[model samples]
Target: MAADSTRPVRIAGASGSVSDRRHAVSMFAANCGDDKVDVIVGDWMSEANMTARGVMKIEASSNISTSKSGDTFAFGDAGAAYEPTFIEAIEPALSDIEKHGIKVAVNAGASDTEKLAKVMTDLIKSKSLSLKVAWVSGDEVFPAVQKAHAEKRSKFENVSTGAVLDNWEFTPIYAQAYLGGLGIAAAFAKGADIVVCGRVSDASPVIGAAVWWHGWSRDQIAELANAFVAGHLIECSNYVCGGNFTGFKSLESKGWHDIGYPIAEISRAGQVVITKSKSGGGEVSTQTCSSQLLYEIQGPWYFNSDVTAVLDGLWFEQLGTDRVALRGVRGELPPPTTKVGLTARGGYQAEVHWFLTGLDIQDKARMLEAQIRHALRDWSDKFTKFEFTLNGTAGENASNQNAATVDFRVFVQAREEKDIAAARFLRPNIDGMMQGYPGSTIHLDVRQGFPKPIYEYYVTLLPQADVQHKVHLWDGQEIEISPPPQTKTYPAQQPSEPEATGVASTDFGQTVKGPLGWIVHARSGDKGSNANVGFWVRHRDEWEWLRSLLSVKTIQRLLEDEYRGKKIDRFELPNMYAVHFLLHDHLDRGVSCSSSYDFLGKNVAEYLRSKHVDLPLKFLNRGKL
Candidate 1:
């Protein structure tokens, strides 16, 4: 290997969330890889995380930690700073982070980069660490939003659906625009040891680190796209290293609990090598990389605030142990518009749960529902929603009493606080415990039946010219930025699935019906109101079988019970040998406001695995039955 003027920049993602910082540090401590990481990036701010932070900022100074006993929340200055969890998590490893001149880049600043900078600088000073901390701001566009609404009475439209703001039932309390890597790169160029920002795109830290190392410009479209692809690959940290992998069977259970985060070795010429720490326990295979490549992505053009990356013609190869090289990504000029995430109070929701054990569980649920409706008839109209779901069930069998149990979930959403009170939703169930279900029982968590504030999200787009991506240098110098010059034209194309490769007679064999997971692996996540699920097989020969079996109708049939009220779109990634489906509005109103059991849609794939599917005996057993 030849070394250019700029060495291969090694950028490693440490934590996907500030909350992950503590465990991430533990993972890092466990992996004592000799190679020094040039830059470490941490993404603590996510769209859902931002929404929760906004609501907490409105409700209280801090958020309550679920890891501890009831009701105690983490508090700081009311609106002055972000959650200090990241700061605290990194304190124990301050020495390690500054070792070998390893600089840190993170978007854990949440809503206030200024305050985060101050808090971090104070901590650094108190620790007497020789590290300079700089920050980037201007992701906040709430003032602009207010101005646009007040002055023009303009209705901000959804970027995906073009739905106007007036259609929303709630107004936003916080709005943040997506930022690019220029500010981060600028800060790093200015001799800063740590670069912090608020609401920067998740991959921006990696992009910035690469840009600073390579001295690349915004116009370096292809090069920046390479860095962008590398950043996107490792942005979720452990995802590239067998974490939540579809091909988990390929990797044994060893060291899985202590999965290592990913490290990207990128070249100035746009080559990428993804690997993990030698000491950490996890496999970095082509399958893992493929799985992550399609995670939460929609369509072909991989859009980031920095560049529009072309996923076509990309290649993945395993160079050596725990290393995979990704190359051949093309790119174009950045999009004219950037996404802005806004959050509002959606009102309140209350929930309660009951266990209907033994025989006639379904009948018991029906009776309980009928009685509740009759009792709350006069006041039932006040609620925005009233829902009941049979959580889990007992199969037909002769077994222990526990095997004969099923849970009934009673959920309600109301506009007025009084409409969803305990008296209205929770107590009404208590009245039925004796007279309704024969074997009714209560859960240990008595506090579940209560009202809680719900937050809603409204995502839209703003022209790049309207927002400023600026850097705040350590020495108090500010640099304003403009988008790169437009240089290419992207023709709109309709999305269509690959032509099905009809199965052959030789491929036919005895058929068996069982869980999909018996032969394939799956991963599910959320993209706002949409639920994204990707399924793949470990063997290349299984690709056709998997792809052919997972048509739009098949996926709909599998997820029909969970469908929220929209059509499902299926797309095939022949390169990755995977099938991806996006179920619109399946998450109800998205993370914060969703009344769905799986708001994040993280469990959608696992649920699909439970659905029985026909499997060719040759594919399942590689044998003639």
Candidate 2:
């Protein structure tokens, strides 16, 4: 029998990333109430994760070349090709899943879907559970990308830098297209109990599960858009339930030991109410939802493989404790292209750190840099890039020794391992300690100085028609999924800066200069080499003031010197009382190869919040943040 479409579909998010708590599946399965969970979705892949898996696959193949049998390397070997952690996460929950008749969807098949699917099927059999498993594939498109580039059909341009791949110096190894949810929906429609995927979009599983439960057709654009937003909100599991919320102080009393995962009660009318299990920790309020909504998004228009969500007018209401109703989301046809990530072997990198203590920290750093430079001058040209940075400043008149000490770092990258070897990189620094400035000492651990392999990540768009989306059922039946009939082409350039509105006047009476965090909350994340930071105020009165204060020029001025020259795009979300900035080429060559201290860009929001800005005395009178 089909599910009743009138009732809302309950979707639970179990895992946010590869490292998220492993027991989330069991927790969600065991905590169901009168309104049970219909489906569980887990997002377990990222750009860095793909690169690491690709490298592992390549290394495993290399090792197989010298084997006795002389057989080709097999991707079926789950250890090197897929995320084995998913098995652990779901193993204990099998009984609950079977008892409750719940469906499971996950993108844990990092590089190999069929293998993981087989493993899951065998596990189900071992438990004597009558569950059917399926897998989705064809996300890998390295050969197709190369062919397209060679035929001049596409340039495979870097989305962040606008650089053509023709001039790329690294050797390409892996490419995967972001697929839509229709494939997962197809598997579920065929009675699949568990669906595994490789490179589907992070939110695709939610959209797929919703589509399956509601029996939605391809033309249901508005409902699909709502599902897309719901997916994004809970895709990070605990994120929407105070995991990364700025109001974490409030959750400390509730206990952070078992922070809850998020659930979306999505209705056929496109309405969504976000909540969590009764037994879990953490609170769900409008502010927490706002934080998750503002995270990792580039602009007012949030693009997904299934639908393009117009988030400009999106708003939320707190109905009760741990329940927020999302509203006002609009929809459009998905963009003509879907994002694709390509990984390449960039080379090797190494770093070493030294402690600078007490007075003359600046002079001590300068002396150490000069000494290292002079020592390595003869071989400096061998390195592709070299950098010296003095991280943080010692506190003035410090009471503790740690407070009076700062770190000096030296980082280098090169084409060959020998160029960044410890003998060449760390020996000079060690020898200079005797003649170095007073109180100068290298870090106790020397492992960081050793060269390690790194992979460069590039993101671009591929036409939907180019992707070979398909689903493999447990019974060996294969289903091919076609591209959507409707898609709109959006301008490649960022949208024009939005004009400030709703402000009665620039003047807010009296003012006090203080950190922006005093009245604003923020969240930031990375997309390839680009980073997005979004700021939102709690009260409606602060909306106009925030819009007037955070212009593009002001943001550029506040950014670090290295990021000042990079291009930036700013957009507004009026309903959320928020402004967002997208910093391009901000993380070097993305997380796998970036040398930045904040490589993942998670701390960019906190850094921005720390910047001093004039605040309205009236708003400050309400209370300190």
Candidate 3:
């Protein structure tokens, strides 16, 4: 391989390994293979990643030993426990780069720029590396800009000022504000060897580099958009190069112990070529690259670098190992309005579900609503906000063979636990026949599970003045940032299991644990558990064979034994071999209700695993079961 200095240079992007940081840095070092690149990007954090950055900071901060699933109290102001292990692997490469005068830039933290900055400032100052400071967090800002657009009376008003003055009261769980790449590009242009920043929109890193290197302008929106897309593909670090491709087969055969990080070889014109380090995990297929092009994108008008992209003529094909060619992506002039970021105060919320059954399903649904309001009467004074929603309406509509069995959801925000707890006690209301309703049904389950904080999402645009970049440096200089003191909290104890109230039965003896597995199919007239189970299965012949064995009798027997007395109506689709069962009312002595059609239905495959049956069960709606 030959090295070229005249053309826009390429960089290696890698990070995000469960092991040590050295693994990620080393993976990229080996792939660069004598070629000197411009930058290095490390990615951590998911799209809605809620992991507290405070936990990944300062060396003194201790990680809470308790698991996050059961505890929600991990919010400490102290920086998080992040060991920059990847930076270790990059040591040799950094040393080599210093020899050749090539620069490097790595993220301070993947999620929170504010937090990453605190930690990164410490590292650069302590290590004495000639690393420049740059902060990138446009993805976090975009949604705020979107909300401002919707809330403010006019776009011309200083919407960002409104949001900031209001203390950014409308923040989402995850914010990916599309940022212009100019600052990042300027950092590179200024001869920074290593730049540290936070949450730089994936595309911005590359777009910034492109503009910085080529001196492109906002008027070159399409060109900028193309660069943004190319950058975006490589931004996820490995997805575009096949890290998460569902179509990936023969992964072991691909010899990907050290998976490659993607690199986009872009031109001054709006053309791009996708490639990865020679030694990377996964493939660089056109399919894989295209998947990244549209990831989580709501529409074609993807924003970045102050431009909107019009991706009409995207085309790509494999180009040997670890390489895929891309062309035909077009972009148009962007809208005049700029996007902004905001975080607002949020209200408490509760989600409640109730099962409704019997003929005249629509009328039954109406009656169910009335009963819900009546049940809430005692606690009505405590709730400041309340909303009754019919979740999974499409699934409910499809499940009504004779009559609809509905799950109605009610959400409320209240001052005290009992105000919310009122709904939990009301779970037993529909176990049997009601005063005005015919036939009996179980109330099934209530979302009595503890209520967690929920936030509303809003997006708006702020005038350019409202948003500005601030960079702080630390040369072992102590900054006065008082991270919340780290405190350890014990996990809550689990409740003892309730003693069995009745004898258990194992009557429907035989078990065929093929695709259906050892699923406890619910009975008919059950509006909750008897819902559809959906999964993807290739190879039609195998599916048809599985379909042939799942007899109505087999399904009926499963229901009979599971529910003891209720009957079920089985519906099958051999093409997909997906099954939907409409279940009968419960037989739990009118005390416990079985919701056969609730939520997304049961984990039939997982249940079979619990029974020590190893066969896989494919459902129609739920993901792989």
Give the lDDT of residue 24 in candidate 1.
Answer: 64
Please give the lDDT score at residue 74 for candidate 3: 26
Order the candidate numbers by lDDT, best to worst.
2, 1, 3
On the 0 to 100 scale, the lDDT of residue 501 in model 3 is: 21
Model 2 lDDT per residue over 1-625, tens place: 2456789989999998887888889887876555478899998787767777766666676773221211112222334477778888999999888888889999888887788899998999999999899999979888888888889999888999998888788878889889999999999899888999988998999999999889898889899999999999999988899988877877888868779888899998778999986767997889989999888588888888789998889989999989999998999999878999888877788788999988998898889999999988888899988999999889999999999899999999988878777778888878899899998799979867877777888889888888888999987799999888899988887674844656667987799999898888999988888888889998877988999998878887677575658888888888888898888888777788888898888888888888888999999998877
Candidate 2 collision pairs? none
Whose lDDT is higher: candidate 1's or candidate 2's?
A: 2
The stretch of ten residues in a row with the least summed lDDT in candidate 1 is 65-74
Stretches of candidate 2 exceeding 4 Å from the true structure: 33-35, 62-79, 498-502, 560-562
**Candidate 3 lDDT tens digits, 219-314:** 776678778777767866766666644444545677556455677776667567778776546777665665455442323345543556654345
Measured on C-alpha atoms, candidate 1 has an lDDT of: 0.74
Residue 377, candidate 2: C-alpha displacement in angstroms: 2.3
- Where is model 3 more than 4 Å wrong at Cα? 1-5, 15-23, 30-36, 42-115, 136-177, 198-200, 215-222, 250-252, 255-259, 268-270, 345-451, 469-625
Once fitted onto the true fold, the runs of candidate 1 whose alpha carbons sit more than 4 angstroms away are 1-5, 18-21, 26-33, 56-81, 148-155, 160-162, 487-494, 498-510, 622-625
**Candidate 1 TM-score versus the reference:** 0.90
The TM-score leader among the candidates is: 2
